[model samples]
Target: MNGPRHRIFSPITRAGRASGQRGAAVFVVMLVVTLLTGLGIFAVRSASLSTMASGFNRQLTQTHYVADYAVLAMVGELGLNAQVHSTNMTSGGSTQCVGFAELVAADKTPSCAQYGYGELNALAQTYSSQELLQPPTGTYPATVVPGSLGASPLEGDMRIEVTDWHPAWPILPGNDATKGQLGYAMVTVSAIGLVRPNPTGMAAGTWDTASATAAGVESSRAHVVLGPILMSN
Candidate 1:
């Protein structure tokens, strides 16, 4: 029997195998971490978008309410006097009454005639003499003054504008020289209400000059045809 055979060992090969196993484990962990991070980012973005949409909806609703109030105010004023061309009243009397003639004429003249029978005719003639003069007062019965539907808590960015007031006449055929004309004094009123950008980063584009004019004309025409108060956000 010879001396006990010494078992041969390969240290380098064993160490190399162990190192490969460790690298594989590290790669798996890194992949899992990357996937989790991507999922977290997607969730955050979704939440932000949802919040923005909700805020936008709320602002839109508030703007619509304000617009509706303005339309109602205009209609009430018109109901007081269908023939009255224009009248404006502000809250707490802070603003003076603005009438159609004042808006159109460069120089507005005050009436000197007292309220009476013959004086009424004289006043009508005086007003008729001026191309921009409005219809005589008392032609439209006085009604309750409208209150301010200010944009306060909802959104501080709101505006109202009265665009046009005119008569609604039936279109006459060019060929018909003896056509009977049907006419009615149509009071066209237009207003705009806006809601400021919400905290959630949802904001609508501001109405530019052209857009405002177009919207005013469209709204006036719609209300004239419908004969009802119109509102929009």
Candidate 2:
């Protein structure tokens, strides 16, 4: 057998090879850290946006219910006073008249000066001012059914202001019908709702005094003009 041959070594030493491998590993680790950081930021931003949207949506929903409730309650309350009267004539005949809120004629209406809305709105405020007391004032006047509790996260109010009135109808012969006029009234209602972030004091978290102001709040409002209800004598 011929003499064993020795292999020549390259210029790069083992230490150099190990150092190169270590550098590559370091680069990979840095890349992974950067990617994780980006993902974390994205997650935080998405969560924040979602929270804001949720808050806004909650306010909108609450306001919608508030408006709907206000309208329905107003109508229901006025409906209770509705009346149907039949006047009998001397000739043994009769006429029917419905008494809802008072009726308003075209000529004698005035603007809603109380709420600062001018004549631009279809229904104008008339009749002398009466004290329409609302219990527990808030962003608006809401009639709370008996024993219902309110929460702080959402605050709201509803109010109905009567603006006009009309006399009852369908008179019998020689009957002074206007003396016992059924209710014919026009009204305007307002419903307002508000929501705000939980206060720092409300829960356990690291909170700064300045952060309390930064906490966001949202609000929603609805208004409607309601009309002529039949009132009883």
Candidate 3:
């Protein structure tokens, strides 16, 4: 009998097996590369969003501080009895009322002398001779002083409004409800603060359109009610 037949493995079969293995390895490498790229993109986007949120928060806080400060500054400027050069309403080049408190309830009549008496006429003598307080009218831009709020790189400006508080009173059977609360006066203060790019070389009391349209600008507003200052005849 011939020696037991020995089967020899063909080179083609072995080569085919090696080729299949190589293909599988290439697929694994490609998948790993794609996953790594996806992860990198996600990380970059998350970081960018976090940075933007942080900037917004900082700007908002600074603006709020500026608004509150503006309100307080205005109160100081007007004091309690200083005469205001009110441009909102005037007759004969002067307001009908004599004092800031008096103006609270002064009528907007065509004639300054129509209102028989102003609200706080009793206290007019307190600051009767003081110079008229010339305040800016409407909403006007204000400057931010450097180093005022410590070592802050942030810069900003503000606008403020002051006016009489006309409180509506509940009508009673025997009352002149239209006159509102008599023997008392009140004032309303409103302020808006804005955070924008530094106005380093800009002229005082002036803001350019570029700064006004800049991105990431932030703002805050404050509204406050001041006083029921007692009034007497």
Local distance difference test scores for all models: 0.40, 0.39, 0.47
Tens-place lDDT per residue, model 2, 170-216, is 34346544644432333333322222233222321344455444333
Better of 1 and 3 by lDDT: 3
lDDT of 3: 0.47
| Candidate 2 wrong stretches, greater than 4 Å | 1-7, 10-12, 76-109, 113-152, 159-233
Candidate 1 global TM-score: 0.47
- Ordered by lDDT, highest first, the candidates read 3, 1, 2
User: What is the descending TM-score order?
Assistant: 3, 1, 2
Q: Positional deviation of 173 in candidate 2, in angstroms?
A: 20
Runs in model 3 deviating more than 4 A are 1-9, 85-146, 149-153, 165-184, 199-210, 213-233
lDDT of 3 at 104: 39
TM-score of each predicted structure versus truth: 0.47, 0.42, 0.53
Q: Per-residue CA lDDT of candidate 1, range 1-233, in tens?
A: 78988976699988999999999999999999999999999999999999978866665565566555445544544554433323221111112223334633655332210111123234335646531112222211253232222222222232233334433344323422332332333434454544442222222344445333322111111244212222111
The residue pairs that clash in candidate 1, if any, are: none
Roughly what TM-score does model 3 have, to 2 decimal places?
A: 0.53
Task: State the displacement of the C-alpha of residue 25, model 1, in Å, after optimal TM-score superposition.
Answer: 1.2
**Highest TM-score scorer:** 3
